[model samples]
Each structure stands twice: as structure tokens, then as C-alpha cells.
Target: MTLAVLLLVSSALPAQAASNRAKQRKLTDTQTLFTKAMRWGEFEQAWSVVDPKARESRGLTGLELSRYKQVEVTGYSEIGSMSEPDDIVVRVIEMRVVNRNTMAERTLRVRERWRWDEADGQWWLQDGLPDLWQGQ
Candidate 1:
């Protein structure tokens, strides 16, 4: 019985490890999509990643229209991430943005929430610009 129990535990360990890796990969993918949308000025693309409730609350259409203006994203760095069964919270350490004409770069630390929608088999932004580095 002891030998059988040990065998069962050994088999379970690999499955749990794989599950954790999958969750991490999903979180990374979600973060990548967000950065890509910002870099390309694809607000609609970004909006597509947002939860429906957040979309409505923030007037997604207006946000998309406003993003028609030119903007540049220099880089993104992941500060950390926390995982839930169906969601992930990521803290970005470095996000650099530049205005088209001003040629000035602004770097900020931002935190965002991403959700995994099992029904759609996709990950999406569930919240927005929750906090800035300097309270601005």
C-alpha cells in the first residue's frame, strides 16, 4: 500500500507542474497581446481583449476613436504576476510611451488584470490602468 501511494504521488507531481507552466504561458501571452496593441495603435484590437463589462464601463468606442491619434510604445517589462484559476494579475515595471510630435518619452509602472475566458478559449484584459507609478 505504501509503495502504491508513493507511485501515485510521483505521477501527480508532473501533472501539477505542467498545469502551472500552462498558466504562466497564458499570462505571458495575454501580456504580449496588450503590449502589441499599444505599440501598433490598435485600440480596437486592445478593446477586443478587454472584458465586456470593462468595455462598457470605459466607453470602449470612444477610447478606440481617440487612439486613432498617433502614439509609440518603446518597450514593456514584466515586474511580476499572480495567478488564479481563471485570471492573472501582472505588474509591468517599465512601459515607455512617446507622443508623435513632442518626441518625449514617458516611462511608467502599471498594473493590469487579465482574465482567461474558458468559453472563448482566450485571455483578455479585465481591468485598466489600475495604478500609475507616481499616483498620476
Candidate 2:
């Protein structure tokens, strides 16, 4: 019984590690895609990457997105991330934007919540950008 239990446990370890690795890979891929779209000023592409539910409710008229659309993003940096329940991760991103009419340069800190959607078999942005126009 002892040997049988040990064998079973040993076999399960590799399976568990593989599952974790897979999840990590998916997260990395999602992050890369998000970073690329955001840094390039592809707001629509970024919107496409957001979770369907969030996108539906927070469409073009959403405060978060509307605020972003009002400015021209020059650059961005991924500063921090925190894991959340339900396979979600919140990321703190800093963006450099130039005012559309005034051309004033400012740095904005935005928070994006990302969630892994099992049904879709990938990660999705759960929340829209925070008040990126603050302190501007």
C-alpha cells in the first residue's frame, strides 16, 4: 500500500507541474500580445483582447476607454502585477501620453485586470483602464 501510494504521488507531480507550466505559458503569451497592442497605440486591438463581458459593457463610450482615446499615447511600461482570485491578475501599467490638442506630455498610471477564461481557453482583460487622465 505504501509503495502504491508513493508511485501514484510521484506520477501526479509531473502532471501538476505540466499543468502549471501550461498556464504560465498562456499568461506569457497573453501579456505579450497585450503589451504589443497597447504600446503601439492600437486601442481597438487592445479592446479585442479584453474579456467579452467587459468589452460588451465598457465599449467605446466607457469612461476608461474614452479617457484613453482623448490622448495620444507615446509609450508605456508594465510596472507591476498582482494575482487575484478566479485566475485573475491585475497589472499596473504606466503610459506616456501627449495631449491631442495641447501636446502636453504626461505620465499616466493605469490598472488592468486580466482573467483567464477557461471557456475561451485563454486570458482576457477583465477590467478597463483606470482613471488614466488623473494627475494630468
Candidate 3:
């Protein structure tokens, strides 16, 4: 009985590890796509990467998108990331933004919160959107 149990447990480990690797790959791909969208000023396209719950609650608006048009993302880089409980990943992103009208530039750090949605089999950004004009 002991040997049989051990055999079953050992057989499951590799499958579990493969699943983890796949999830990690998906996360990396999603992050890359999101970063590119932001850098290129594709706010609408970027919105698709946000969590559905966030979208439903915050709801992207025309005024909000207009604000993005007022500024251009000059640079975007991920400073660091950490994994949290409940399959959550938090990342610190540094962005160099320039005001289109004034041509003034500013560096801002934004914290991005991502959570793994089991039903969807993917990760989602819990934070609705980056408020680039928050204190401007």
C-alpha cells in the first residue's frame, strides 16, 4: 500500500510542475503585451487586458481616454515584482510621461496588482487603470 501511494504521488508531481510552468509563461506574455500597448498609446487595447470585474466596476470612459491623449508615454519599465498569497503578483512599473501640450516630462511609479483567475485560466489586472494625470 505504501509503495502504491508513493507511485501515485510521484506521478502527479511532474504534471503539477508543468502546469506551473505554463502559468508562468502566460503571465510573462500578458505582461509584455500590456507594456507594449501602454508604450504605444493603445489605451483601448490595453483595457482588454484588465480584469473583467474591474472593467465592470470602473467602466472605461471617453473622458478618461481623452486624458491619455494629453500625455505620451515616453518610457515604461518594470522595476520589480513580488508574488503574494492567493496567487497574486504585484509589480512596480516606472513610466516616463510627457505632457503633449506643455512638453513637460515626469517620472511616475505605478503599482500593478495582478491576480490569477482560475475560471478564466489566466491572470487579470485588479487595478482598473493607471491614473497618469492624478496629481498633474
Order the candidates by TM-score, highest first — what do you get?
A: 3, 2, 1
Taking the tens digit of each residue's C-alpha lDDT, what string does model 3 give over 28-128?
99889889999999988889989999999999999889999888999999999999999999999999999999999999999999899989998898997
Q: How close is candidate 1 to the true structure, as a TM-score?
A: 0.69
State the weakest 10-residue window (summed lDDT) of model 1: 127-136
After TM-score superposition, what is the CA distance of residue 60 in candidate 2 from its true location, in Å? 2.3
lDDT of 1 at 53: 74
Q: Which candidate is the best by TM-score?
A: 3
Colliding pairs, model 2: none
Residues 5-96, model 1: lDDT tens digits: 99999999999999768867886786678778766766667667778777778765564465445457676677776765545555545777
TM-score of candidate 2 relative to the true fold? 0.82
Whole-model Cα lDDT per candidate?
0.68, 0.78, 0.92
Candidate 2 per-residue lDDT, tens place, 48-130, comes to 77788876886766665666677777877889989988888888888888877788998978888888887878888877544
TM-score of each: 0.69, 0.82, 0.96
Choose the strongest candidate by lDDT: 3
Q: Give the residue spans of candidate 1 off by over 4 A.
A: 67-70, 80-87, 116-122, 129-136
